[model samples]
Target: MSVTRITDVSEPLVAAFANLVPQLSSSATPPTRDEIADFLAQDGVYLFTYSNDDGAILGMLTLATFVIPTGKRAWIEDVVVDEAARGHGAGAALVEAACEYAHEIGAKTIDLTSRPSREAANRLYRRCGFVARETNVYRYGG
Candidate 1:
């Protein structure tokens, strides 16, 4: 399969997430078709899928780009490959597509995070040229 940048929502895309998102998180629910459409309407947001010739989506990732006083920035989020598809370069392809798109949009740098428990993902990140930063990442949720 190959990476495809998605601008609109479809039943297949929604179904793809139904299968893919749960593989990434036990508590997370997949995005609805409307939600996907609304998200794509926002500026500098991208959703990419890796699908085969027969139209099976095997992987997906989201890229968010924005500008601040410093410069353009991009973040890759929710990267996941089918459990059966891992180790076959699908994740790397998704990441590479994100980086290429972010660069085309003028992002100075791209960033993503993976839990240490996700050893395979961390290794994939390193293989894709992402460096680990020696800094704290804090999050607050209400």
Candidate 2:
């Protein structure tokens, strides 16, 4: 599998967005084409897609890096692999790519959160050298 940064809005990417949203969240709606274009245009946000030899997208993730008063940080978000593509390294590839990119950009640390119910995903993260932190994760709004 190969991972590539998505630089522009295209039909294939729009289709991939449609295919991935349901996998990422059952309650969240897929972003519109304009929203995707806007996202791609945002500074410090990197979107990557994992694909096979035939160039079919198997997974995607976004890495957003920004500088705060403390230091530069990177967050891996919206990670989703096609249901049929799970267990075949697409997820790992995406995470590795994101981590590498974050390092390249001088991020001090990369962070991500996974639900406890996602057993396999949690395990995958552990295998990729992610340690569970003893901290509270709070969300403000729906």
Candidate 3:
């Protein structure tokens, strides 16, 4: 599979997001196809899709960019692979593409979060050369 940023039409990503939304959290709101398409067109967000030679999407990774006094950074968001495509390295490939994009854009670091329940995802992150870092992340939803 090959990974490329989403642009033009992104129906595949919308479908993938639909599959992932329910798994994220019970309260999480699912986005419509238009929302996914719009987000893909936004600045500083890298939405990469993994597709087979036949041009069928198997997985996707969304990297949100941040600019702070510390430096430029990338936060990986909503990485998901179709249930049937998990073991073929699609997830890793998507991450590799994101990292490469980060480096290309002069980002100093990249970060991602996984719950303790997601053991396989944590393993994949470690295998992708991501080290555990101590930091506090707080979220407030209105």
Which number leads on lDDT? 2
lDDT (tens digit, per residue) of candidate 2 on 1-142: 7999899998888889999999899998999999999999999999999988988888999999999999999999999999999999999999999999999989999999999999999998999889999999999997
| Lowest lDDT 10-residue stretch of candidate 1 | 28-37
For every model shown, what is its TM-score relative to the native structure? Answer: 0.96, 0.97, 0.87
TM-score of 3: 0.87
- Evaluate all candidate structures by whole-model CA lDDT and list the values in order: 0.92, 0.94, 0.84
Q: How accurate is candidate 1 locally (lDDT)?
A: 0.92
Which residue segments of model 2 deviate by more than 4 Å? none
What are the per-residue Cα lDDT tens digits for candidate 3 across 28-100? Answer: 8878877776876788987888888887777878899989999999999888887777888998999999999
Of candidates 3 and 1, the better by lDDT:
1
Return the top candidate by TM-score: 2
Alpha carbon deviation, residue 62, candidate 3 (Å) = 0.3
Which scores greater on TM-score, model 1 or model 2?
2
* Candidate 2: residue 4 Cα off by (Å): 0.5
lDDT score at residue 22, model 3, on the 0-100 scale = 65
For candidate 3, the clash count comes to: 0
lDDT of 3 at 121: 89
